[model samples]
Target: MAHSRLQNINNLTTIDAKGAGIYIHIPFCKQACHYCDFHFSTSLKKKDEMIAAIITEIGMRKNELEGQVIQTIYFGGGTPSVLSNQEIQHIITAVYNNFTVIDNPEITLEANPDDLSNKRIAALSNTPINRLSIGIQSFFEEDLKLMNRAHNAKEAEDCIAAAVKHFDNISIDLIYGIPNMSNQRWLQNVAKALQFGVPHISSYALTVEPKTALYTFVKKGIITAPSDEAAQEQFLLLVDELEANGFIHYELSNFGKQGYFSQNNTAYWLGKKYLGIGPSAHSYNGTTRSWNVANNMLYLKSIQEGKLPSEQETLTLSDRYNEYIMTGLRTIWGVAVARVQQDFGQLYYDYLIAQLQPFLDNGLLSFKDGIITTTRKGKFLSDGIASDLFFLR
Candidate 1:
């Protein structure tokens, strides 16, 4: 019975009927992590203005997702936990006023360890926000210092202990492939997270993005570049450990227990429409994709003038096909051969099969029931394999 239930969670493909999602980007952080490249500011001076602009953007785009019910409301960041409870409530109220929401939408707040004190978690528990995605990247002092995370190792454990008391739906972020993280250390990290009993875990291989401090450190040989081979080994270890503990490897970078999959991200992988409100947030319908300007000042000025500070592009058939291949292969919902034929016609379907043949023959991908999914051996390489299957014109 337990096995069957887990299987059902792993096979989930569709989202709620007529459902969409909303993502609100809070662009302020207390400090910068060495490896982060996402748009964010370290200043809090403009936070009030930023919040007001975001609420206004939500109102202005109210009709954009007409007739669809919002299934998820995600507060992503520069660290959304920095907002006061009242501020968070105000933003959520704006969402309710502007859009039609489901009876109990999965509202998530991306938070940092330093900000989630016992008092703060209690306050957040009273709000409509029902889920927490905490940034507890590593529970080691060295790793925390290396990454320049604002919180210490003690704070990492402290926050989780406090959080589970108030929120049952919690997910924590972990990084596995830091330059000096050994396989044993990585295993220890996984062990520590399991001890916390978090139902969902999102782990990623740390890559130094261009222009980040990590990049500069690597360029100057102050820190060794992360090894791809090491990352692959650690990833496989994570899959084995997490799955042994009843966690489903639902996506390439995410693991969740039954009933704990991230609704917001699952909707995204299934190609559902969602509106993004704030600086550097992105929005997508089935046909086009748009993103707000990354500059906070520009976003504030435009929103103040009652204009959307964003740009959009329509997706061509080839673009759509490529995206499905990319997102589909990364999750349990493999790319459907029938979906390709029905949506893009015979030519695309044929081209996809031809491109996929080599990986299939090499045991990196498996095709059964007309669905093409990455095999366990191919999981780490899914992105590269997906690129090989792109329907380039």
Candidate 2:
């Protein structure tokens, strides 16, 4: 049955007009990484219950995206790969039963290296999941130990070797800017990922989010905080190396070969509607945004009682315009002047143009053909620039 799904894998690489996506957050993991703060439990005791709640949430909110087609179904969070093939299939079947999914939707599974053993990867190849986003944070053992990742350095390399034989639409993640990592080591990390011949790579700086184990380490001086200067240098190095090797720096932290950009994430960046199921998952329509509660037990209890455990807010005009600016400037697609004028008003258009002038003059932003985009020199600072351009309420 899954072999038939492989026939259309090539067709699932690109994004289309099918605007809706479904993001299922699997909140169970084998263990928590030290540098992480996303919601997930270290125990698998409630795994079955959580899966039931996720499927129920899918049916209960079917009407939220009533007429839209689901172009992508993404399994993200603690470690989606921790679920068995049967469990994963059950949730997917539920989505198909409730939603109008595209004929060849891009179904992505976020797997950690340790969870993707040779047998596991082969079994997954037979499922509807066509894309694998492996979390190979670092190629060095020391870095892996520092981050407290479940997989060691060897498991990281071996998983990619095994995965490539079963999956072609693959993406591996790498983190740079660890406290003591040199630029040379970061380059080697990028080179190791390239050796696998995967189509997509999502690299991010190791940020010290408050309340994570890494934060505590930094606070107690057991580990030094990652330096901003070092991070920026590594970020620029990544951009040059990947772009030179034929990957487009399509988004701030994502690079992909042509026709291989992340369909699920691109949909979000383009302002498409998506339903986020499971604990701590966020959903967005054009006018409003909502998210499920982060507590796994509470989520299951609420769903069992036939109620939605989520909160939502309607977006104001300023909220919409500011979001467009933030997401637009992060991608190759620049913010359109006409869109601001048409979507907001002449007042917004004038304000945006006036605000962007400083960045335009300083070689940080470029304005061409009425679209505003960050220059090569400005890509690393895009977030800060986007904030300055925001229409403060």
Candidate 3:
């Protein structure tokens, strides 16, 4: 039985999806949020040039994943909605021209609530983009102000309603753990999202990253740091409410109705090959991971010179196993014990089992058959727990 399970896991190594996915990063935002530390520029002075450069980069890296179909295309970063409908279409056209894409690829755009006006939603529906991921951090005015979000309470509600009319495959982002956020407020936020009939929700607990305005505020006593207790309580509430409403906790931070999972993210977590285009974007092809230069000017100049402004590192065996463990523990898939043994060798499998004993003993992890997964108590702490299990080189 053990031999067969290990064999099946070993076979997963060669099982590639029909095609690779593409990620296009648009790293421009109109307003800088207080808590965000992602690489983005607030100025749109070079927007047009950036767009052209991204398209050019697409062509330059066309052969990176040759012989594979482009299954998913994701527009992420500062604010994908900042681009005009025509600008977006131009890039999509470039993609079609440069790559072999399927008839109906899953194309998603991460839009802000303020950008999803009725007209804009209608125009987007006409495009090939089949999914929308709205950044609706909160539906309350106080929380929005605290986060320095550009959109207000009404826009949050109105946009989702407007988006639902045109797009069925919609996902909205919500943030929890804001200082002074009561449990009741959190419940209301979740309820409002449910009222929208959105098929998917990607919610996260707000954290204070260094050098961000939020961190400075906390240091100056302007804002209270996020409470772990509150975050855990809110996360539990989210799981209970969403699961009751027929949403699967597909990934740690993602919930989707049946057949509504984000194909782009799923492909990423499954270790499928993907190409990322734009400043600060990252790409992976099963072994090597690469990231573009985070500076806008440098990226454009590099692309114009017909060179990629990116750095890549090939994965070692330990790196692959650790990545698999980290991502696997955060999703419903869990870590496949047999796969660890087959791919990383018996030493790794034995090491993993030994490392897992404490978590299993503490009821934070569970092992059944040949799989090891986080228990309900361990869900919120999955990342930390996975780290403790990492195999250091």
**Tens-digit lDDT string for candidate 1 (6-81):** 1123445546658999999999999999999999999999999999999999999999998999889999989999
For the record, the alpha-carbon RMSD of candidate 3 to the native fold, in angstroms, is 5.7
Tell me, by TM-score, which candidate is best.
Answer: 1
lDDT of 3 by residue, 244-315 (tens): 999989889999887778888887888889999999999999889999999999999999999999999999
Best by lDDT: 1
- Give the clashing residue pairs of candidate 1, or none: none
Model 1 stretches with alpha carbons more than 4 Å out: 1-14
- How high is the CA lDDT of each candidate model? 0.91, 0.90, 0.90
Error of 1 at 112 (Å): 0.5
The stretch of ten residues in a row with the least summed lDDT in candidate 3 is 1-10
User: Model 2, residue 205: what's the lDDT?
Assistant: 93
1 versus 2: better TM-score goes to = 1
Clashes of 2: 0
